[model samples]
Target: MSLAIDFYDETNTITEEQLNMLLELVNHAAIEEGVDAGSELSIMFVDNDRITEINREYRGKDQATDVISFALDDEEEGEVPLNLGEEVPHLLGEIVISVQKITEQSLEYAHSFDRELGFLTVHGFLHLLGYDHMTEEDEVEMFGKQKVYLEQYGLTR
Candidate 1:
């Protein structure tokens, strides 16, 4: 599949190689979920303040979140091939991640920043693909899938 990923950040903490790895992980997850070719997704990295503002505006939460995803397609609609309907590409959705949270969680979890970031990236990507953790069973399934994806990418902590 051809994927277009855009990474935006207020600071240059994440290296180019790290971003590339994230893209690879997300794409791998997409393929596993049977996403068609020419899919596109965007990831934005920001500070705690920015993510907190977005969390408040979108989710009505006043706290900073590690990551948030906005998906364009509805999963219930079935696995239809994404059609751009024009020369434009199909926009899967956007994922916003808090780099500050990644740093903090890395320290708290006693893992490298790369692993934490990779986990967050895959978590957000799964959300975009219509996976959720609203119930215990759902949480188990979703988190299990996330672990599998991260492990496949060699991002185990």
Candidate 2:
């Protein structure tokens, strides 16, 4: 499948090789999820302040989250308008990740930075694929799938 992952490192904490690996892992996630090729999504790395603002504005929560996803393929009321009659979609939505929080979480959870990053990336990508964790069952399914992808990517806690 053709998946374009625009990885923006605003924090500049990660190297080019690391970024490449992250992008590749995202592609692996898409393939695992059975997403059609040619889907495009954006992943932005930012600091806590930026993420806090986004969290407040979009999700109505005034706090800094590790990651936030905006799904763009839905035609539901109040959501983004769907692309009609288009073979390739321009947007599947965007994922905003907080670099500082990632490091903190990595340390807090006693895992490698790559592992935390992989978890967040996989979690966010799943959201883009129409997966949600509003309930216990959903959370189990989503987390289970995420764990498998991480294992395949060699990112273990």
Candidate 3:
């Protein structure tokens, strides 16, 4: 499968190794989740202020969040038309992460920065794949999946 990832580091604080690691993690996630071959997604790294603005604007929460995902194909089955016999990239939408939050959460949760970053990355990826933790049952399922992915990917706390 060909999964194109567009990465933007607005904070410019992430290292090359960290970026590459996340890219690999994302690719692994796509494979594990059976994503389409021609799928495309973007991951943007921002600061607390930027994420706060985004959270306020999009989610109506005036606080910085660890991650926010916008899925392009989140509409209902009948809402969006199907691609008929055409070879085109399926847009998976974007995952915006707060670099500052990563650091803070890692410390707060007593885990390595890599672990927290990987968790957030996979969490956002799951959202792009239409997973949500809205209800108790949904939260169990989604969080369980996240733990499994993180453990399998060796991003343990």
| lDDT (Cα, tens digit) per residue for candidate 2, span 70-118 | 9887667777654587775667899999989989999999999888988
Q: List where candidate 3 sits over 4 angstroms from the true fold.
A: 80-85
lDDT of each: 0.88, 0.87, 0.91
Candidate 1: list runs displaced more than 4 Å.
Answer: 75-88
List TM-score per model, in order: 0.90, 0.90, 0.94
Models sorted by lDDT, best on top = 3, 1, 2
lDDT of 1 by residue, 78-156 (tens): 6767575777776789999999999999999999999999999988988888889999998999999999988988999
Model 2 clash tally?
2
Cα RMSD of predicted structure 1: 2.6
Q: Give me the displacement of residue 155 in model 3, in angstroms.
A: 0.6
lDDT of 1 at 13: 85
Candidate order by TM-score, highest to lowest? 3, 2, 1
Error of 2 at 14 (Å): 2.3
- Backbone clashes counted, model 1: 0
Per model, how many backbone clashes are there? 0, 2, 0
Higher-lDDT candidate of 1 and 3:
3
